[model samples]
Target chain A: MSSSKLHPLYKQLLRAFTSRPSDLKTSGRLLAELKVVLIETGLIFPQTDYSTQDLVIAREILEIGAFWSIRTKAMPSFDRYFSQLQTFYNDYSSILPHSEREFPIRGLNLIRLLIQNRIADFHTTLESLPLPADELIANPFIRHPVNLERWLMEGSYSKVWNAREEAPAEEYKFFVDSLMGTIRNEIASCEEAAYESLPLKDAATLLFFRSQSEVLDFAKQRGWLIDLTRGVITFTQKGEEKLEIPKEKLIANNLAYARELEQIV
Target chain B: MADVEMKDAKSKSDAKDDIATPPLSPVSEIKSNVTLIERAVSTLEPRFTIRVLRSLTALRKRLDDKALCDAISEIYPQDSQVRSSLLSWLPASPTQDESMEVDPSPSPKTPSETVPETEIYFRLLILHHLLASPSTYSEAINLANETVQKIQSLNRRSLDPIAARVWFALERAYELGGELSDARHLFLAAQRTASLRHDDETQASLINRLLRSYLHYSLYDQADKLISKTNFPTSAPNSQYARYHYYLGRIKAVQLDYTAAHTNLQQAIRRAPAPKLAPGFYQAVHKLFVVVELLMGDIPERSLFRHPVLEKALRGYFDIVKGELPVSYSVRTGSLSQFQTTLSAHAVSFESDRTYSLVARLRQNVIKTGIRRLSLSYSRISLRDICVKLHLDSEEDAEYIVGKAIRDGVIEGRIVHEKGWMECGGQKTGYGPEVSEMFSRRIGYCLELHNQSVKAMRYPLNAHRKDIVDAEGAREREKELAKGIQKGEIDEEDAMGGDF
Candidate 1:
């Protein structure tokens, strides 16, 4: 398909998404957090959920996937409402990192693990109740209520699995495969963040700070990346003194980016 | 925060520093890794550029002992930063008032002998400094010779036939600095060292360099014998020996032997297409080829320098040589008149017609495009030093002329050479070149030199003018050579551009 139609729509969408149009329930403070999640949810289910509905909220969270506590701190007045919301998000909370935190990719995998445990507990609860199968489906809301099992394949729930095979001929195999795939996928996404790439000059500055400090352990624990000279840093002797100069490291670009430039993958 | 700026690749500053300076031949590093990291830190400016250099020096010298020689078989020089630090270490003259008020203190030079490393380092530092200082070449040579006699392992440029001292004096010979016999002896001495070394590429390269120096005085026989003997790999014989072919080829062209010239020229072109050619060689090759092709009547219709065969050769050499050429050219103050006057004194007068046209072309294409820039700057050292070394005239006359040339932007100034005076940035005018501008300036230099030498043959005591026949015509003729010294390695006695 031609990209002529593509540019304007994306341009319009970006502007609309960035602009928070209206306040939501519990004011707009919580709405931004909700907005972020809805964005991740919408991106995964762009076909399933219409972009016109409650999307500005989701786009914010989808953009960075920063935690709700960080968002709450960014908006201080609605503390109690976020406090209530935090419990549903967290368990056994004293404002925890939450066994199931938000969608920062890393936290998503943790949340997946927590949800799996919660699902197991719900199954156990049903087993202990001894409820008849018809009775479970007998309630007005339970009577074939929106068979979300189909949505599971496309919605946010299923996207937690990697883009690779989520289905299997063998039930046991698919479970293990998708779980591992999801973990790897999240790690890959988080690794691509800007914070991870320490520019050489910046790294040098950071290293200088490290050298000045007596505490090497503290600096190392910070997980800060240290960039080496990247290439040969030789001195060209000029008159009274020699001066040092940097040689930048050059690496081949990712195949996908090169494809865009040269129009070949 | 200090703004980090990349130094211009061919800054006049860098060129002037390298010009006439002996090889730094710095001692090997005692430790490479720490110094590399330290240099990185210093440059990245944890504090400042100079401060880091100073700190690196201290760290490098913070060694325990040289007695660990058995473990450390080779000794590299301390961090390069030490040289800069040592400059500050120069002892200042004691003030009478301070001297009278001072409590008794021990001299820092105490037992300077016991510290072998310090002694060697300081002595070498003095030599290095003197060599680079525009006016201090003679002083540096003296200090280096004085120190060389006492050292064990020498890391000098191995300038035999002309002992290091002799070469130093000869360079100053233009200023009447050293005795001619002494200079010859030193040059020969440098040649002797090459003979002693095994017939390796490095040894061959050094031999070639020395031979080039010999050829400067038209020592054809010696240069020929030296080239023939080098056991270089035939494909590339004699140290970086592509030159061997060029020299032979040049001789053939000059002899009007087209067949021999063609064969030699072809060989030289093939071998030196990308060989580390000097600026002179590049221009010389083009010169030789033009004469050969013209003499052979092969390219009567083709431009001399622009002929395909020669153009490729010129481009190949210049691509590498330009890197070494000065980023800019500087004209000595009062240099234009001196050049004209100097020319008028000679029979081969530079009539305004040719110079005017060329100067106009240069102004239009080079200066406007910034391919070349003209600057005027003060000279602490000038050609006066050369005059003094050669015993040509009084220090005053040489200085006066050099000073005037500097003002007129004719010749460039030397390092804190004590040959001239200082002036403000705008006050001390000079000329510099971009790659393209170099061509114009070089042409200008050739014409002026030609004029100067022709005068020498008349009544001006041109004892050396015999070496410079028709230098003025060389520049216009060497136009095909526009491509030869781009990387800037090519330096010729008279770098004449040929219009191939």
Candidate 2:
């Protein structure tokens, strides 16, 4: 109950957690120190000999680690802490009140899985959850990746496109944006098979690009001949120009086929 | 035994006073509780600290917020003994209720310690509650101003976290109390604190709030400047990141970056908190998204309108697109005045929400639809014919609109400006465009994949240690070469590119 009675490093870890330095470098150094303290004290890693207070401090450290890693966009770092926290939560959840951060973290994990295109892992992860998928779906965080995977598999490109605005979590957008990149390519192929060339503005709209500049960048990346000053994209003007088929041979073949049909009749 | 004797002695000294202080009023209750806690704090067990703070906060709820703030301020400096006692418990009590006052305890036992950072955090929380719901705007502004002065007086104790939280709360209060410029200045100061700490997440959250404040004040240039200077955190908490995207989306929409705007809005919507948590924010984003989609000339799916939460908000926009009203394409081109009148009636509600741009885009949507129909109905049409059919102001205007539609790929055609006719380019022999576009996009993707693999080789985490080993090896090699040269055994004919 006293500072002296607690783990020597507990006070230090608490200070870092509660008044985290604003500077990234100092914050990073503090996090590294916390990890070392946790490891040295056997609060993390294998031994389970911990007091209720020690466990509480360890959980606090892990939670903040997860938050900081995610904030820095360090997914691998975040992944380690989140898994540690997940195990901790499963073992000690009954002793503590539900953390508001739990569902959001779970939701973020689902999105990370979706982004990496690990659908199998995503399903397996969801299946192993304590709650039913139906109940999880009630949360916007869980619903987003689940719904996106469904729409993607179903070939509902529009639905996937529509999801851009309905993503349940912020990090979900990072995945959704990537998913859209894939969807756009698919749609572009379909449109190419069906039409000669769409208008420049129409192409931009159809491709879900929000600006002419973006469309032009994409067009350039695609090696399309775009006359931006005139607002027209000529999609078929590169190496295939020399591969045109002979028009006379096609007509003669058609005439011969008609004559052969007449003789058979 | 020492702890017990100290506790008894303190209780006996305060027992008569506690008995004298009646609990008839909430203020009296809080006062007595504070005194009792102060008296017992030095000898009190660390585990009981949170319980005491919770009781103080409970008493806080019953007292008039403004009166309680006044009372706390009055008692705060006068009771230095209690303040220092509370401070003694501070280092060991990070989990203490953040609303309770915990001063920098001048306990002789820990005299050399830096002020616990939580002291500033708790103080900021107190100031936030005071400014958050003051009975009047003047009271809120006055409280904010006073807190700013108080915080400045603690300049010597200004650590990064303390500075960041204090500035954030003060600026927030300023913004709420309708002082935009002052809020902007403090926001910049808070931003500096976050930046100095290299706290990307805090910086992004601050930027989002600042942008919202900027939007509210219509300070477009300032918002643009801030966004250009700030780097949005790619890996922040989804809620804060979602807000960043949402605010960015609104700014893009205003700037006519409809493409970027739609992307940001989509991210905003995707990352937006679920309906139960922040329904209003979700609904607002959805409304903007729908409007942006419409402006881009895409018909939103029927299912999108089926969401019960968004149905009511998007109904009017839905009706216009779905043709629940009798507005026809012919009417859109034939009578601009009549169309404007009808459109204004349907779009009036959006005006209040500053969606004038999207509402105005309705005409463009109508014109685009009319031109698409014409291309299907006829092979070629004179510019004059289009003007008459669509009821435009002049041939030039019609030509400009048609030309824009053509460039946008709404209609496949060439405008013969001299002949004053639009020649529709039919979809024949167009495989080359699609095939090439697809090929190029694939090629581009492959290049990016290659680049990413090359970049992944630069992992700083492991690279630093590796670099040290490499440096040590190079130093050893140089030492051996120097020894060889000293013995005159090195060949002068060695290759020029060899390691020195």
Candidate 3:
């Protein structure tokens, strides 16, 4: 805020500062981001406006992101920030952002949103979204150069008078999650383009996707994954179907393949 | 102005000792000799430039080849203060000639008699700097062991404002090296020095350090004992006192006296007032509180314990000790993380298969002193049991380890823990456990050191009467001051005098 050409760290603070009317290029783009955030998480609610009381929760989450972005951007070690990404998931948003009041965009809420979108045929399971691995290098989770920098200057803080970097483990986790989420989206988009209409649902995670049957089962527990058991489960048929962009399209591609063939049979 | 100078002397620990004696050490002589050698090796003996090359030379020659370091330790300066201060930083490897690497212990300014005021703490600080670097453990342990042994050789009282600092540094080294007993002993010893200076600010600062070492060593009794010694918020202002309470909170928290732990820890946070106390402490404490709360499931946050800082402080402190943070910053700000990392690294590099030999001393002390009141204390756990656990070659090695434990006050019985359990000195009344636990170790130690047990044991419980008398005397004195205030004999400004 003090200097123009805001630092990446200040971007979090800036994002939090302008919570009501978020600067997401467009509200549509912002919702797209939010929808993805929701899909990955299992928020308790399908939708909660970040206009009133929820705004405070959103701001805190954003501030926490900014704080870690500041620290992560300064570190030099990639592994260190990666390790911290696990902690970020557990500490910051694994549970709902409920100090006194619950924010709807918590872990389960996000998961639920994805489930709803997937049911309605939203874009695709976010995991399948295309993302650039290089973009991930900038994602705080992978950007360990900042941590290495901090490590390099471990004794630097004391040798000179300077403000210590904030290291709230919880807040740090939030930053890692957001960055990783962004990276995941980036990678998902890339993989989506690469694996267009694959037989498997998690074609983006193609290497790890189990047989078509296993993917269907895993999708059942995690409704965010589509169930294309035999494509007979489709709500629309053939080219007449207009997809509404599901929050999660995990099972769709695999399930669609299985279902499309089964429907023909 | 002269009055101001004399008044400041009230808190200067060295003022009294400086009037008396001044004797430099054999180590200092060796140090200066080493300086000469370093000067020969490279013109700049103490520079990082010189050190890198010298450390390489020493490494090539392998200084651990023989008793070179032990000889160097003995050959250090002759003045007790200089010798002890320098020795306190000597490497633990008796074979390591650390001076061979560093040479002439560079003072920021050259050393001189009437010891140029600045150079007084210079060596202790350098030792601290070495410890704070992300060095290996063998080097750190070697450094730490030498540090304390050398400091012991000095007349601590004679150390300037620097002496208190020297002791503080020594305590940190001891703590990091896992010499908990020695650390607590030195910490208490520092407290005594702080009290002698009558400098409450310095005393209070040291008190917090002492309290943390007490917790780490699991010396809850001593920490608890300390609480009754001074009133809360009296030693320093609310902020400083809050830190003190936070440390005590940590002790209680670690001890698992949840009710009391919460009460005090919360008050600590409330009183700390400053956020820079490092919220990590609050977070750690809060997490612990949350843990206890979850464990209890329905327990309410007790009053006076609602705000916790110890957990946060602990998180911060642990990361520091673990070398999760960089060593450079910790060196200046005074985190002992570098020392622990170095010590651990030392154990791994040289000793191999064991990275905890130094820490065994803390266990050894507990085994010897048997201070079970500290909670889950090793002292009550039995030596035979520990021998089996630690895998000593024989009971003698176990006993040797226990002797170190006795030094930690971690265990009980001096002779039983000491190697020569059979030998009886002139005043040895029955070295065996004939009496209660309280009188055993403290009494035996007094007799061993003083040889006048009859009078010493005559008041075995505590010098409580003296303590009461002191308190009563203070209350009576304060009443007179109150009366003076009432009578307008003392001005309001006078009553509220003294800067914090």
Candidate 4:
């Protein structure tokens, strides 16, 4: 209702929430413009006397900014917006959007931390939730991150990857995809070390790539040689010398496995 | 008319014979002598009254104030003409100058100066004054100080009884004015003098009074030290013993020793003066008893709520605990918010009665109850379900509560961390050590109840009236039988057939 009388910068920033940024360039441009307007109003410095509507609008813009940073895989930018949202919630929660909007972003923020392998920070974030885990998980937004964390801890890569499709909000999908990407790379590295080579089709599925071209690009980055006629990718030796494996560790692993087998009996 | 005349003649001759014969012990001698004064005062003869009053005045210097007051009160009640003459020695109300004139040595004298009989009577009067009109507390304290000064100046070793009583009055004044520290300080000083004189009654009563002050101010360490350092009397006046147990109960309750606290509180309730005589002390002990029972994780007996005196005070807790919207319902149904509201409603009353700590434990009780119900409903419930049911924040918190419950023997279960499940061991059965211990405690309680009832029973010849002793015994037996059936020690069908 007060849309017409809002500051010009506030109006422009409001666009971020109304429409999703089409590409990284547009998102980056909109974020830069937001930063300039926020600085000019001294809002970045926490200027006083902003109306409740203004604070609400500012919180919405920051929420979108957080999603953009996650989508672009920029963690520091995401942290900045998330912390600002936290301040807004702490100070102006009465005027800001409902908890429904806030919890999903927090959930996505947790996914980003998981993807970045910040286990300690992930737990710290989970600990900060005011709601109990049971009540918290009842909300789809909050449950998405919690389930992701549990699945990741279980080392269930497939479950973590499948979780992307079930994200509660559109912005959550960005971080879920990022988490899957990290899981895929982790599996790729383990596969490379465990085996000399694998067929292209197996490699594509293992890497969670829908097409061979994506897997091919990834293989190039890992310095693997592809034989299109043979339908196989070959691992290249790094140096002109033989690499020795640690026999002690292999024996330790075997001993542990044997103890576990004895326990099963 | 002839029979009444003969009965009066026989009573008078018996009284004369009792006095003519000296008693075996000094206690019996004094008892018979006091009764002689009572008989003489009833004749309304001026000569007999004067003779008895003079003898009592001489004996007052040697006897305890309590016995002197009791004997003299027979001739002169507080408002009598003789009592007014005794009051001429008190420093208040323009009597100080006249009393000073009688002290021929106007200048300060040492212990040898005549220890007036009226000085002991003055302290007695001051104690009565303080007890009746609380506004005179400061004035009473000032008078006590002056008397202590005079007694110390007299410097007589045998006047310790007089000094002890003066300090007792001072302590009562300090306690009345809410100056607990001063009261305790006076108690220590008086105890030293009373003990040195080997005055057992005064010292025992003083310790009982001091323990109550310690409890009121929550000076638990001081109370514990006094109990340990002092040689308690094997027997004392019933009122003093009752107070001793009541304060001991409060101290133990503060220390969270509910078992010992329960024993002491029950004793206090039993030994307390009748409700008509000291309702305040009687009701206070009863309230604390209820709290101790609750802390022990056992519901108070329903009969406790039926007392005309205790019903009004205990109704709130009874309603929240056993009435509609019971705390158990909240826990079993996961209605934490409702439980919280109920607790807060009674918080003020609980704080005033000093049962706030025990009542605050209700939250943990509710949570444990929720976990136990969950265990019964599902053999293996995920930590998430426990969290939901207990309104806990996380699986880790639920795990911690469940782990504590298992350790405390409130529940039997193992937590599987990897699977995040609490695998309940179902309900433990068989005559294990825990069951045997429980059985022993129940038997101990039943025996204690039986012993108390026996001690509490009235004469069998008077059994025509409503016998509280019989009723309490029947109630306890019913409770024991019900518990036996619940524990499966007695089959219900067998109980019915056996009864039939």
Candidate 5:
């Protein structure tokens, strides 16, 4: 719990975190121990007074934990790390040196929100950024997701698919892949609604799938019938339900309006 | 010129009188305000307290260390510790005449018992005074922290109104000291207590404080979460409602919900104090309102720019709204270069107003106008020519922009992708379902307005009783007139003339 004791544990965490191939098991254990030590020293929420060196080490440890959590795909733990790091990032920002990993983590959080389809939360996060929009866009890490969001809104699926190669970080590819999956499903639904039948090659191209087999498998999952004789996929339309108008409610609403108008007059 | 000279001479004499009787009038005013607050507590009516608060703005300008010190000593008993502690926050008086006369003054004291409401009120005044100077900001923060703790511990229902004011001063102190987030937990805790006690005034003030702190840091998500988790009491005063609506409008606007933002901003404007009374708030709300309206693809009314309080502050926004400047004229004419020049020219002001992002989004509107104009002028235009005319970067960008314009219904055209040309469609006649739907919407709005007005109409209390009394009086008068006519004692011409 003391500062001297924390130094060794932090060093060990750093080693485990930086080792080739990323020793997740050992580093995870070291991270938990370091977190306990940091919390005991009042460096997490930092209620008590702490020395500058201790605060810096504590912040770096949490930042590493955040990256490690994301690499391991433990999203809840990553979120916890993010919340803890906020105090250091915002409150003590004047005292501490800027961390290099701040923007990347923030960028990752934005992509995480996008992958979850929480567009409102994504914009809220963007608005909370300390930098201006142009400055944010100038950063390659933040620009990737911002461009993806704009392209997604514009219904330019091809731009998003091309954005996969332009991701700034390796972890970004994971979220981008999931986003592509959602986009593919959206495109599939639109294709079904707009088309009667399409050739397998065209469908594959439209869905951003390179292989014909992938398109066929996806088409099968969507309940489309594939005909080998014509080399095409056919969508069968379901029975259209009758549209029932709420006639009584409409009449009652209008009648109420009329009654109120008469009283006003 | 003679009238102006007389007015200037009168003001000069008034200034001399102010210097001569430094603490007399202001101290007496404070004493009267304290008496009013006491009466409010006894009557269980918050309006008297609000009246005292309303005069605080004028009283605050006259307050100095000497005046406040004298006022506190006069209000408190000879041996009151609250008196000494409140006096300690003020700087020692320098003038020998003022200090010599302030001590040992034979001012009448009401009671030895000091109410917590008066104590909190004094603290609020002292906090505001300390916040006026940058040097005493830390001291003000300390006082605010101590006062908050004292109020929480007292837990009296009568303290709610003054406590709300104390919280406002607390927010100001923390904000001035640049440590607003440090006091966030305090506000959150106080708000929880206020809500549990059902103290609507304090709760409303605390909510606005917390919202302001969150927004200062640009933490929209937290502010939005706080909004969702808490219910804003409708019984709160109009000032609190205006602040609530303004914060809500900011959040909604950033979230790209322009229609909701517009409505909330309009409510804020309606509920806000007169423009001269709160010019900063009036200007801030209008600035955001105009931006929201533009984002919604509607021009704000020209009259809005002519408001005296807003005319200077909203000059940049006015140029963007009305195309008054040559650059903005170019913007209205769909020149991309001109729009860029105007945006960069006023970018700093826009950034400071926190509307930079929203205004930047107007680029699409500019491009849409350009495309609409181009479509109207030329039935068939190649993508290359469109790009050259619009100052677009490339033919491909133009194609994509045109495609999006068509999809968004900004233009009626189809993109011939193979030939890389946009083929415009003929304009349709006005007789269609769209026109009918528009008419129906207008009718519905008018009916709804009529219904709302009828509901909101107010009638005098027990009005029918007055009508009954009038009818009885009329009957009596009729009987008297009949009796007089029957007795032949009334002249018909005289009665008719009098009646006419």
Candidate 6:
């Protein structure tokens, strides 16, 4: 629980985290121990009373925990670490030395929101960033998700498909890949609505799949009819139901307005 | 000769009255205002309380330790504990010359019965005075905390108006001390109590205070949650309504619900005080309003900037609005570099106004404008040329951006991916479903407006009888006045000028 005790645990965490082919189990265990030490030192919540050295270490530990959560795909834990880091990043920003991990972690959070399709929250997070918009866009870490959000809004799935190669960090690829999965599903639905059938090669290219087998697998999952001889996939057309206008509700609403006007007169 | 003249004037003034009344000081003036508030409480007339509050702005500048101390000592009896506590909050006066002469003369008929309203008013003044200096902000915060507790414990109905004022001071103290979030629970608890007690004024004030606290930390989610959980009292004053609408506008704008945000900002502007009276609030509201308007793709009226209140505060916003003019010119001409330059130039102000993200979203409009121009000028364009003209990073990005523009119906176009060129089609000129949809929307809006206007019309009770009676009385008075004038009993100047 003491600073001397936390130092070794943190160093171990860093080693486990940075090791090529990171051992999630060892880093996870180390993070748990580090959290306990942080709670004991009263550095977990980042009160003003804690020494600056302790606060810095506590912040770094949480940052590593955030990255670990992403690596292990434990999104809820990532959210917890993010909320905890918020205090250190914001409240203690004046006292502590700036952490290089801040923007990368924040960018990852933004990308995580985008992957989850929480576009409103993505923007809220962007607005909450301390830096100005231009500076944030200039940060490659922040720019990746911001650009992805714009591309997503524009219905430009191909650009998002290409963005996976340009992720700012290795860990960012995890979220970017998930984002691509969402985009593929979107592109699949659009293809379904637009066409009755397409050749396998063209479908593969349209869906950004490098191999025909991946398109077939995705097609099978979507319940499309595939022909082996012609190598064509057919989309099942939904029935074209006639639009039914709610006549009664419209009339009732008009009557109510008329009645209210009558009373006013 | 000057000495002789001074003696003559002094003797002449001395002979005017045997006992000279002390000259009126700020302390005496404030003491009288406190008495007026007491009279208001006793009579249940709130207008007096409002009058006292109106004078507080001017009186705030004249406050000092001696003035507050003098006022408190005069208001409370020598044996009163409230007097001592109130005096303790103010620093002891540094000057002794005036105190030595005035210390011994406590008002002879000091009332043991001190109204809690007066005590809270004194605390409010002292809180504002303390807040004037950064060094004393902590003390102000402490005093604010103690005052809130006292208001809660006293639970007096007469203290409701003063309690609202005290809460304003309390919020200021905490905000200026840079510990606004720490007082969130305090505001929440007090708000609950105020609502339960049916204290609408304090409840309204506390809700605003709580929203502001949440917003100060950029806790928009919590602010939105607080808003949904609590119902703002419909009977709250216009000022409170203005504040509520302003905060709602801010929350909605950040959430990208531009339509709702625009309506809320308009309501805020409508409910706000006259611009000259509260220029800061007026400017703040309009700053958000202009940004929301731009985001909604409507240009604010050119006359808006000519208003005396807005001309100075909206200079930066005017530039941004001006940059938007070309977008509306032919719907095809927009300068991305101009938008970027204007945005970066006003970036600091926009950031200060918290509209940077919303303004930055205008870049999309710039791109759309570029695409519209490209579609108009060319029957077909290669992706490379599009990239070069639009300053895009690459052909692929240009293809995607142009495809997006086509899908969004910003232009009638299709991309030939294999050839890497876009085919532009002519604009649709015939009547379409979209035209009918627009007409229906307009018709619905008109009907709704008519219905609302009808509902908003108020009819006073027995209005015809009252009008008749008023008319008869006015006629009788005019007849009497005319007779008097004919008899030369009234002077022409008095007859016409005085009445007018």
Best by DockQ: 5
Candidate 4 residue-wise lDDT, A1-265, digit = tens: 3333336655555554466445566657867877766666656545577766667666777777887787777889888998888777654555556655688788877777777877646654554455443455577877887677655443345666666788688777666556666776666655544344568987787567999999999988878889999888877643633444556755665565566446446
Docking class of 4: incorrect
TM-score of each: 0.25, 0.43, 0.25, 0.44, 0.75, 0.75
**Predicted candidate 3 versus true structure: per-residue lDDT over B57-163, tens digit per residue:** 22222122122334333544433244433444444444333433443333323233223222233344344545443333345555544544443444333232334
Q: B1-500, model 5: which lDDT tens digit per residue?
A: 76567546645655676787676577788888888888888877777889989888776756667668888877887566566566767786553223332322222233565566887888888888787667788999888888888888788888887888899999998888998898899999989999999999999999999999999889998899999999999778899999999999999998988889999999999999999999999999999999888777677888889988989988888767644233222323355555666677888899899888777766556556667778777899999987787666667557556766665566776665446688897886666545645765787888877766676676754788989999999999989998898888998787889899
**How high is the CA lDDT of each candidate model?**
0.35, 0.60, 0.39, 0.62, 0.79, 0.80
Q: Which rank order by DockQ, best down to worst?
A: 5, 6, 4, 2, 3, 1
Model 3: lDDT of residue B482 = 85
Give the CA lDDT, 0 to 100, for residue B334 in model 3. Answer: 24
Per-residue lDDT of model 6, residues B331-432, tens digit only: 333456667789889888888887888888866765566677778889999989888876666775676577666655677766665566878887765665
Badly placed stretches (over 4 Å) of model 3 are A1-265, B1-117, B134-168, B199-202, B217-219, B229-243, B250-260, B271-279, B291-500
Put down candidate 6 lDDT per residue, A184-251, tens digits, no spaces.
Answer: 87667655654556788878877788998898889999999999899888779778555555567567
- Can you give the lDDT of residue A210 in candidate 2? 86
2 or 6, which is superior by DockQ? 6
* Fnat of all models, as shown: 0.00, 0.00, 0.00, 0.00, 0.21, 0.21
Q: What is the lDDT of residue A151 in candidate 6?
A: 75
Give the docking tier of candidate 6. incorrect
**Between candidates 1 and 2, which one is better according to DockQ?**
2
Q: Assign candidate 1 its CAPRI class.
A: incorrect
Show where candidate 6 strays beyond 4 Å. Answer: A1-11, A32-58, A94-96, A132-134, A155-159, A188-203, A219-245, A258-265, B1-36, B43-51, B58-114, B132-139, B178-182, B331-334, B368-500
Candidate 3 at A161: error in angstroms?
65
lDDT of 3 at B254: 40
Cα deviation at B323, candidate 4, in Å, is 8.0
Model 2 per-residue lDDT at A113: 75
List DockQ, one per candidate, in order: 0.00, 0.01, 0.00, 0.01, 0.26, 0.21
Candidate 5: segments with Cα more than 4 A from true spot: A1-58, A69-77, A132-134, A182-207, A220-244, A251-265, B1-35, B65-123, B146-150, B153-158, B319-334, B364-500
